[model samples]
Target: MKSSTAQYVMGIDFGSTTSKTVILDRAGNMVASAIAHKGSVSNDGAMVSMAEALQQAGITEADIARAVSTGYGRRMLDIADKSYTEITCHARGAVHLVPDARLVIDIGGQDSKVIAVDANGLVSQFAMNDRCAAGTGKFLEALARAVQVPLEEMGPMAMTAVEHLSISNMCATFAETEVVALLAEGKRKHDVLGAVHAAIASRTLGLIARVGKREPVVMTGGVAKNVAAVHHLEQVLGMKLRIPPDPQIAGALGAALFALDEITSPDHADEEDRVDTEMAAARCGTPTCTAKKPLPANVHPLHGPALH
Candidate 1:
């Protein structure tokens, strides 16, 4: 709560399954970051994660001057000074990680998107496969379970495949059935995993073509961590992909960059946010405000009512 601590900012990306958070100092350097599963990705989850990150940074919530949020749960976050789409945040995050990247492909928990970045690092055009989970991380997660491969070990297992089997279906339920049949036929787990990765890669590349792509491509999102998926995507695209240190946090980092911009830009100097406090109080008037008490410590402004 010291005056010097006011130079920090926060950004949160609350995706369907995972929520990412990034905190930056006045110089726009990352001070702390975190990712958490969505089972608690709402207010409590974000607060818990933020609290943890603050603890690591040896700071507190009062140190954050502004907070920007993005992703599916942004609206529910309530503490955000502003909200932006994942596309913008991802584009910014990519450019920060890879300054020369012209094309960015992000395959997240719920969907996949390919974005073209302009010279100024803005998103120029984009394509998304959001109608279903056909070409996304969710598909890979389900396939991993069906193939009896642990989520983190899938990439390595696929690489061990002796035969490059092909998966013709991308629909989750249908693909699950196909995998079940393959297992019944005594197919090798390695081959099944390879097929799944290849199918996802092919589908994702096709999506990129729909929006058009450029060179110096970079991949973001949780899916990018799958070495097999990245390898397959490289083959299908016939190019190399620049990957950040931790792909899952790209959205969060981008949002933090935006917060830095908003804070440092003189034009927005007076635009300090009071939204989090206003929102916490507004939601307190509801009947479902169980416990109906103020939050603990600095949490009182971020979460007003102890709703059930």
Candidate 2:
């Protein structure tokens, strides 16, 4: 007999710059997701904001059977059924979206991470450079301003550079100085922008190398969509990087997929089992379902795997 249990899960990525919530059915299909523009909500406000996001997705507070929170402010989400590091969530999310992804480079607004995944979608090792803004979305935003172009136009404009100018510094302050000098030199705006992209790509490639090069390299996070950055990265690495549709949503998507896996397999709560199930479903071409039961108000938040 078909089980009547409805299985709706909620995944919230409370990033440093923005917060996003995704609702998925038991089958791991995205039902509804909402993105909030501001930074992570304060501890007292997380539940309220999360509830509002759920409502936006037509999810009642009672409908979410499991809630997994990730990102910089994940620990502040006291109401979550569990909380996970952004690295694990991103790796699982990337593998869920692209099963063949062996490497994941997630460059978020303030941090960048490179994760190596085995054939089973398990994260083998990873490295991150979160202490600096030089290799992240903020770096690109600052460069766009230095070039007097809107941020959205930076990517396509960067691709137009016929000559590759060199940026001497990786530090944001020093790089800004370099950009000013390039501008004074009467270099083409596109060339300067290309130089900036090249600088960030070089630093990111260094991080990827630390994790060991592997293919197919899947680039996630907001900066992955920047054509110039992507192009420069490919050139520097001498390998093609795969950028998925809506790269900014990868973490949230991964969290949602993790939620689905938890609901489907109650007994096997290990991270490896969850990854295996997601990979299996993706490989078998099974349709992800959206059925879920309402969560009880008093139920305790889910806890992630114990840190080693």
Candidate 3:
């Protein structure tokens, strides 16, 4: 395999509410990465959107020796050199960020995942909660709206609570209703926010407990940025959770690592030749094979989407 030090690889993560692209050298050192706000490829064309992200990062198509796509739209990216599940990519990315991480908890826009990793930065076992949106970004967004606060301010607002209010509802709609009721009762904003954080933390902890708590629980995904949620999760799990400096970009980083592997693999040369032939044929006006389309909006597949 070629060392990441000698080649450039590109990774794209087509997330549910945003897309990110990362460029890295053979050593897995990131050159540049960019995140763009967009709907999941499941509801939009993920591959086309990913291409735009790469362009924004100034990474031309030819600059990417190998590309790996992950997230909900992975399978829909026909241009990806390879595709991987979000769980695998998240595990790989988390392990790379925190080499000693035994457990990984990633809370994205639409779902959450828990992963266990071994000493070699490989996934051991994993669990996902995609069927519900209770502890996801969407849940937080709804809560923020109910509280008349910006989504970005939820974490700080949660930290200001002098008392922890009770949130009895786990459903997003019901939870929003609960917030409104609390406000009507004259509950302080901070206390209500704290309760919301606790609710999400409790739900997330339930998922983590299923995989068995381990030391150095690394939190990734967009939700990790929420300090209040992180604090609540730590209290619930009774273990300190480590958040990477750039948690949201972990999946894209892992994709870049996979790209490095594909470029350096012994079979890559032949694969490139085949890909070139295919591209040439397509350019010559031959009917080219199309990549898979994004999943429908209502479809909630258990596994993450394919890589392009």
Every model's TM-score: 0.84, 0.82, 0.81
In angstroms, give how far residue 120 of model 3 lies from its true place: 2.5
Candidate 2, residue 232: Cα displacement in angstroms equals 1.0
Cα lDDT tens digits, model 2, 1-308, are: 11215458888888876676778887777777766656434443345446666777676757777777888888666446567788999898888878899999998877899999998899999999856778887787777778889988988988899886899536877798899898998999988888888998999888988989989999988788889889989998898888888677778777777777677876666565467445544644345522133446654333332110
lDDT of 1 by residue, 1-308 (tens): 32323878888988877888999999988999988774634666677767777787788777887677887787676566567789999999999999999999999988798999999888999998857788787898888888777899999989888886777645877888888898888889998888888889889878888878688999999999999999999999999999999998899888888777766773453333345445545656586333333456653232222321
C-alpha lDDT (0 to 100) for residue 55 of candidate 2: 79
RMSD of 3: 8.1
Error of 3 at 293 (Å): 11
Question: Of the candidates shown, which would achieve the greatest TM-score relative to the real structure?
Answer: 1
Q: At residue 123, what lDDT does model 2 achieve? A: 95
Winner on lDDT between 1 and 3 is: 1
Q: What C-alpha lDDT values do all the predictions have?
A: 0.80, 0.77, 0.78
Worst 10 residues of 2 by lDDT: 299-308
Instruction: Give model 1's TM-score versus the native structure.
Output: 0.84
What total of clashing residue pairs does each candidate reach? 0, 14, 10
- Candidate 2 — number of clashing residue pairs? 14
> Over the stretch 1-308, how does candidate 3's per-residue lDDT look in tens digits?
22224357878888888777778866667877777776655524354545665566565665666778899877666557667888888888888889899999999988889998887888888888757789888899888989999988889989999976889536888899999999999999999999999999988878887888887899999999999999999999888898999999899888878777665663854565466555644654345534344656765322122211
